[model samples]
Target: MLIGVFAASLAFQAGSAFAESYQGLLKKGYTVGKMSQGKSGSLGWVLTGKDGKQFCKSKVSLAVVDKKTLVSILASGRMVKVDRATFEAGIGGPDPSLPLLSDLKAGRVGPQHVGACTPLRG
Candidate 1:
């Protein structure tokens, strides 16, 4: 009985640990380059800072659920779902998404707007 309780506790911890990742905090504009498949077979984008300098030379992958693609930071695996307006504007250009990111960080976003985001390993 004690073992079962301990197992449940461990599972819960693991689940909640990844519930929110550090990626969700990034609000700065990133220039996402062309999409390409990484060596690991994950489809991702090459991101860069607004200055046109190299940001993440490696490809960053996004998880899409129910036609909604999740956005996340490459360094951390935190994720958030933005409206179509936000996504279209932010996906490839310099767009201020601080308010949207803030809403996600504060958990003010509704369940319908929340999606899964996982960082790639490579």
Candidate 2:
């Protein structure tokens, strides 16, 4: 019984220790690069810092919706359904009018306005 309790405690600690959110890391100056595949065949974005240093080696994947690929998840885990066109705008681009990574960090687009961003455990 004591062993069981110890193991449960360890499991909880391990999960919490590594459960850093995508937004949390982005707030720390991490930039999301192009999508890439991991050794396990899973897709995720490469995270880099302002200094050009790679952050997570394995990377994290995002899931916008259950069946639909377009969706946004907030830190609270609230899923907001969005359309493809809207999702593209959230992506930003050469158009300065749209929100970019810098705007994301600057709070131009609220968390809800952003698309799905799930960080994969490397």
Candidate 3:
């Protein structure tokens, strides 16, 4: 019985119930804020690429997963969850904690950077 209860709890916690919607997260600033690649703000934001070209033109937003974790989303239909502590400490950023690479490699990018640049500018 104890084991069953513990497993149930684990499964529940693994899901997005621990996460919040983009706007819902913006409302609660429990160590979370707006992150944008272009002149940071809550809305009217843009995501730029390393080549200085437009990547994702989105109204990106951020939400706190925990005291040290954050979830970032873009209206362009991309999302990435990152570790706020690491990101702020200059260590930075998750994509469901796993990534799938292809046989043919194009560009080399660290897996930690999943979505556009939502640097938690909030």
lDDT of 3 by residue, 59-120 (tens): 22554465666656555434577777776566343334432221001222232332333222
- lDDT by residue for model 2 over 1-122, one digit each (tens)? 99999999999898676545457667878766654443444433455654343323322122333223443433433445556455556776222233233333333343333333434433
Ranked by lDDT, the better of candidates 1 and 3 is 1
Top model by TM-score, which number? 2
Compare the candidates by lDDT and give the number of the best one.
Answer: 2
Sort the predicted structures by TM-score, highest score first. Answer: 2, 1, 3
TM-score per candidate, chains pooled: 0.24, 0.35, 0.24
The residue pairs that clash in candidate 3, if any, are 33-122, 34-122, 35-121, 86-92
TM-score of 3: 0.24
- Relative to the true structure, how large is the alpha-carbon lDDT of every model? 0.40, 0.45, 0.39
Candidate 2, residue 88: lDDT: 57
**Regions more than 4 Å wrong, model 2:** 48-122
Indicate whether candidate 2 or candidate 3 has the larger lDDT.
2
Worst lDDT run of 10 residues, candidate 2, spans: 53-62
Winner by TM-score between candidate 2 and candidate 1: 2
lDDT by residue (10-100, candidate 1, tens digit) is 9988865543322332344544444344444433343344433222222232332333344654433434554544565766743333224
